[model samples]
Target: MTRSPIITVSRGRFSSTATQVLEQVRTARLASRDEIAAATGLSIATVGRTAALLVERGLLRERPDLARPGVTGRPGVPVEIDADGYLVIGVHIGRRIATVALGDLTGRVLASTTVRRPLGADPDLVQLSREAATLLGSCPGRVPLAAGLVAPWREIDLLPREREAELHDLTGLPARTGDHISAVAAAEFLHRRQGRSEAGGLTLYLYARDTFGWSVAVDRGVQTDVTRAASLTHFPTGADVPCSCGRTGCLAAAVDVLPDAARARILGATAGSVRDMLSPDQVVLVGQAFTGDPALRDVIVEAYAASTALADPVPVSFTRFGSDIQAISACTVALGPVLDDPLACVELTGVAAACRRPVA
Candidate 1:
């Protein structure tokens, strides 16, 4: 039961009105034209027109069976996400595991599989790509339109350009890659699905897997370009540990050797530093380190106290996921196109506007 990430683009190449309507329908899961109009504050006529256009774009589908009986000339048919029409392929390659899953337009997982790997070792791309192929081939309904590749920000630097180009060739679908933690943070900000509070201003997102990393989310999106000035990984942990980079001491190395309390304190210090420099409105904790262990939760709570002690305090909470959060984020990337928020596409608002015009 991997939970899908909720995604919302502020402005898409598609009709913002159409995007709004589709977002409403997705949020509601199912809705009639009247309901869409009410939710989006658009005219009923506008809803009908936008929805029809969305259907034409394959982002929506009409459900006549959901229409109520005893309606006048024609009851407005309820529409739901056409989950069966398009599929997203999500790939998350981590030090511990490599995963692949398929999702629909609404980001619902249809099927998934994973393979374990050596911790902190480079992934077997052939094996990972093979698994991804198998998953796509086995999906019962819907056609996969795109693929999303997710890994630690550091992994991006390690992958070769030739290997990167081959991914598109391997999948035969458009593909996207991004920082794993940032993807989750973006999803948290957009959908607020994990029961987290509304995101605004600077948000501190921290996580630990086989490695540790953090990102900043501002105004409902993760800022993927934080430098050493804003990164938590650069904080001094006051411990001399041998780092894999051949450095004498680094925060990443020290954390593994330190106790939970010490690690929390370091995290708190990092949070406090981030607050002083960035002034985030909230703190979001993700990854297995935060939620997988109750003791870590206590450590984080304690760390939160220490971090905010000297700076402006903000709300802090761990994101709870019903399924593998990373896999879902990866899937969200592929689902972006069908959801009308692809990472890249041409704007066609003028075309959409023309479609709304009545034929002579």
Candidate 2:
């Protein structure tokens, strides 16, 4: 089945009242409209209207059954995210494997399947889309609104937009594409937001594995414009390691940190450089380079501490997701539209035609 071209959701758009109410309800899991209004600093009337609209769109559901027994007003009824009502597809095209996953409205990965690709081969969009459709079919009652695709390496022959179009056409779902690193950062940010209150400031995310890269997140949003050339691969670490680009001491050349002190030093120096440049409130270390070996992680940490110029030390921590980072990041990209603008996403996905349809 053919699908309309998916319009890119503007990540730079300011949060709306509906978005605020939805986010408040999502974070609270279940909350009264009054609670949402209070948390979001929105008027009660605005919160009520936004909540009602979200409920109508199937993004949220009112739980009158859980209403306070003594209360006789709308304030007694609580609203919660309708996680089972919708699903989004997340496709991560890694260097060695391509993963397709199903995510709920709450960014939970419901199911996933991975396919291995030959070394340095272009991904088969048709095959990947078929796999995604199969996974979607396996979930009997969920309405899939959109798909998010992420890749570690960009193919010059096929742009990300073209790939998104192909996936959308094949799967009949709106699709968005982005760099895997940025998606990973976004996933981390969203995860932190969901878990606890985030400290106010910038977060610098460092990724090391087959490639070296970094992303910055301001408050609740991640910078999504990371390019391969802009990666930390070219960052000088003052090491003697040779890089494919005819450079010495490139970060990419130090990926093989199998207890090699030199490579570890390179990684540490790069992290320190990032620390000094951004002076982020927090630094998140992710990917196999840091998680694969404890010794390497220690070296990087030590180097980062020694390299920092700030009077106060910045907090540095490893990602809790570890190897599952890629999948979660892709899912975050898919759920972006719904979370950013639920009402618009519901309308764009034609929720009335499918979201409300009964499961067979």
Candidate 3:
């Protein structure tokens, strides 16, 4: 049976007090230092220090009204995660357009801008570099200090160290883009942000919008070898599907065949056609096609039924997410810095967790 993933983000593997505090804040939507201490067993001192640091990082905010009673202990300002204070930039690079988004730390997008740059003719890197720069430069929010980018990368036998550096440089945050922040090195970040352990299944995360991207997480954390388990761009229908690589029939090759393009106003036709093809149990369609267009939902439902007719049906139904598959895919690569195996993380974090989960 397939498994659908549930995402819950917390500072990974925190101490007992921190975990308790996080749960309170996540559920109650507001917390104060003393309140946190009273509710979670964290000492007021530790809570104060941690809360201060998180606030400095823009992860939380102070809520002054929910004051503590002074008779019992000291009164302190209330605190809540600054859901609106900071943002994560998600850039979806595709053959036809690019997507730039400003998301709060919780991964909720507050504002976004999409630019269409006909990319089939440009050198993929030069074009991608320009797009990444453009998105970071133009997106609107609280004047972001750091940018998180997602883009598709060219497939290779081996990737160079310089390529990694170039990606960081593209963000225009040169000093901040080094080892700790680069995609390949931040597995812990993505792993923690992705929150897939409880999903209990083997999954494939296809980052196929601006670029071909992916990540996989199973019941196990980083300790096992899920690399061998991921199928990259095409899983069940690899060479069999028509794709841009000039392959007669590749999984995404038929993306251009959607009939409802005009109605959906989606970037292109691939998404609609794919919807006509397979329907995983839980799909998380990102970008314009899925996010902005509603009729496309029907197209996806029909496509899903058609997908089942194949000789070997995908084992489970799926939820949906993806619009600029290529951009999401590329982000998967930029995302590689964080994973031991970038593709594996895609499987775990993306939709596969909702499709077929590994038995715990």
After superposition, candidate 2 runs with Cα above 4 Å error? 1-13, 63-72, 153-158, 195-199, 220-229, 257-265, 294-296, 351-360
Model 2 per-residue lDDT tens digits across residues 45-112: 98888787777777888888887778667766898888878889999988778889998877788888
Q: Each model's RMSD to truth, in Å? A: 6.9, 4.6, 12.0
Q: Can you tell me which runs of candidate 3 are displaced by over 4 Å?
A: 1-11, 14-29, 32-44, 56-59, 66-77, 83-90, 118-143, 155-164, 167-214, 217-248, 258-360
Pairs that collide in candidate 1 are 1-323, 2-323
Q: After superposition, how far is residue 262 of candidate 2 from its true place, in Å?
A: 5.0
Query: Which model is ahead, 2 or 3, in terms of TM-score?
Result: 2
Instruction: Order candidates by TM-score, high to low.
Output: 2, 1, 3
TM for candidate 2 is 0.85
Candidate 2 minimal-lDDT segment of 10 residues:
4-13
Please give the TM-score that candidate 3 achieves against the real structure. 0.50
Tens-digit lDDT track for model 3 on 1-360? 321112212222333443445434543566667766775566788877666655554445666656665623323777675665333344544356655554443434555556776655432444555554555455533433334343333432222344435545655421111111122112222333342323333433322322333333332321222231122244334224456566553434433343454323222233333433434322233333334446565655454445444454333222233343323323333322222221222243343233232211
Please, what is the TM-score per model?
0.74, 0.85, 0.50
**lDDT, residue 112, candidate 2:** 89
Candidate 1 error regions (>4 Å): 1-17, 34-43, 56-58, 62-78, 117-126, 153-156, 159-164, 193-201, 220-231, 240-249, 309-312, 341-360
Which one is best on lDDT? 2
